[model samples]
Target: MRIIDAHHHFWKYTAEEFGWIDDSMSAIRRDFLPADLKSAMDAAGVDGVISVEARSILGETGFLLEHARQNPWVYGVVGKAPLSQGKSAVEEYLAKTLPGADKLVGVRDVLQGSPIEVFSDATFNDGLSALAPHNLVFDLCIYHNQMQATIELVDRHPEQRFVLDHIGKPNIKDNVLEPWATQFRSLAERDNVFCKLSGMVTEADPTNWTAEQLQPYFDTALDAFGPKRLMFGSDWPVCLVGVEYPDWLSTVKTLADGLSESEQADFYGNTVLKAYRIDAD
Candidate 1:
């Protein structure tokens, strides 16, 4: 199928750096580098990966860029930089960091914990403006409640390309839909925006989630974005918190079973390539 995993993570974990990996996440508290991921990708028939940043730190971006440099299987990277510093600082950081590393295709901020209004800030919008000139995409990693603000932010910058990480991070754990579905439909109305069919496993009843449990959210995304704008992402290592790579792959595939072969191709790889502008070898 020529699968391209649109989202996953690689990290040389340390307690000081990855304090977010608390006691319950011990399974993923250790290091997970390209070597570990390559085996999983191979097992799942994934041809390439766009490694997304797990930490909101400049060093994490450098780490992924170096990994991409060393690993042929890593097709691209979604990096992290402090967008609160506004446009010039972001430009300077990109100038310093992205010169030799061509695999850095996008930038992200872990907006899940932030207030919704943060997306509307002038400084943040200025930082977002710096991306288009560099040909970098932005990965929006906000919770579902922030969709209105996300929509506003995306509306303000039609020139910038964005992929909404985790399908707006719907509240699957509680089976809540309403406002999320409505907000998602609103966000999908933006032509420049794309959505990832990833991160759902962890958001569900992680220990006992059924494909049926995830189907509604998947259906919502598919309906809103259609096959062309929806891409598959494993959200690996972190996905280990809920399901293994093969199982998650199977679940997503099953949900997408109704799609035509070409539509399946778009979900599996083409959408990722088009959205991120990934140059796979």
Candidate 2:
């Protein structure tokens, strides 16, 4: 499929860090480096990927960016430097992060928690505005209920290109899709925004999800973002909580099987190339 898996994550934790992994989510209890991900994505037929930020605080983004430099197949990164850190700090970091242009593709925040008002933080706005001249994209990882604030954030910064992580995180576990659907549909109308077709397996009943169970959410997102803007992401290490790389890739293929070759191209490869501004030699 010549795929570009746009949203995967990596982390290095000795003990103190991954403590957040709670023994409850056992699969991601250790360090997952670029080498491990490359092997997995290769087996799944995904040619490229962008390493996303893990919860290692702002310092981790720089760490990942340096790592991406050595792992060319990683393609790029959506590292975090909370836009709320104010503009000048962001400007200086941007200046220091020069050669990073090839790898630093976007920014993200932990929005699943403080839904509607997270972006309202003046610091966040300042952090967001820092990307203005850099032309880097913003990846919003919000919860289902917080989707509206995402849309509002987009409204305020029409210049920024926002990609909604995991279809605004629809709640498939509870089978609640209405208000989520309503709000998601409204936000999708923002042409500046896009969506990733990943994380559904984790969102579904982990033990019992068939293709039919995931169809509506995928269809809704495709219908909303259209083929041109939607991209495929693995959400990797986080996805290990429910499905492995191969399992999730098979699920995505099953869902995409019904589409035409062109549609497949858009979802699996084209959109990523466009959105991440990937340039591979």
Over 4 Å off, model 2: none
Candidate 2 yields a Cα-based lDDT of 0.81
What is the TM-score of each predicted model, taking all chains together? Answer: 0.97, 0.94
Worst lDDT window (10 residues) for model 2? 93-102
Cα lDDT of all candidates, in order?
Answer: 0.90, 0.81
By TM-score, the best candidate is 1
Candidate 1 lDDT over 1-281, as tens digits, reads 78999999998888998898877678998889888999998888889999999978888898898898899888999999778999999989988988788899999998887976788889988988999888899999988888888899999999999999999888899999979999999999998999999999878877888999899999999999998999999998999988889888988989998999999989999999999987664
Q: How would you encode candidate 2's per-residue C-alpha lDDT over 34-98 as one tens digit per residue?
A: 88998898788888887888773778788888888788787888877646678888888777774
